[model samples]
Target: QQPVQSPQAVILREGEDAVINCSSSKALYSVHWYRQKHGEAPVFLMILLKGGEQKGHDKISASFNEKKQQSSLYLTASQLSYSGTYFCGTDAYSGAGSYQLTFGKGTKLSVIP
Candidate 1:
């Protein structure tokens, strides 16, 4: 099953810090992180494997706990461009290319200067 994300919305001023968490009931093969600007498609942020391996774009960082089947994204010293809705996608192992992802409802983050 997909993970549930907390805090449906958040408001922050520039340079503030925030944390978003994602957790699943089922075992996860991988957890993918993404951020969507108001009018833009979701952009990949990071991917964390069951073995604790991580990969993704620069400027975004995340951590995954295999045993807990959970992940958290850390946003530090926020920027104006960081304002957006964050989503965590969970992928289960179904063999080979059969893996699929389920996204959380999302956490809306707004940043003000």
Candidate 2:
């Protein structure tokens, strides 16, 4: 089943920071974050695997908490370019090392000057 994402929409200004969260009842094998601009395909952000943590980067980052069955996306020093809809795709272990992803509804972010 699809996970639940908080703050369906967010509005920010340049140089600000925002966090988007995703939570699921099922144990997640991995958490994939993506950003999609209007009329565009979602662009891959970061993926947090089980037993691991955030993939450190300059502006975008994320963390997976296996204990809480949740993941959070952090956008720091935001830019107008960061404006888009973010999605968290969660994969659960099906069987035999196979996994299937269930994507959250998506969080919309808009930036103003």
Which residue runs of candidate 1 sit more than 4 Å off their true CA positions? 53-59, 95-97
| TM-score per model over all chains | 0.90, 0.95
lDDT of 1 by residue, 14-109 (tens): 998898989999899899989999899999887888987654344567888988988988888889999999999999976777988999999999
Q: For residues 1-113, could you state the per-residue lDDT of candidate 2 as single tens digits?
A: 89999989999989999999999999888999999999999999888998958775789899999889999999999999999999999999888988998899999999898
lDDT of each: 0.88, 0.92
RMSD in Å for all candidates: 1.9, 1.1
**Shift in Å, residue 76, candidate 2:** 0.8
TM accuracy, model 2: 0.95
Evaluated at residue 2, the lDDT of candidate 1 is 57
lDDT of 2: 0.92
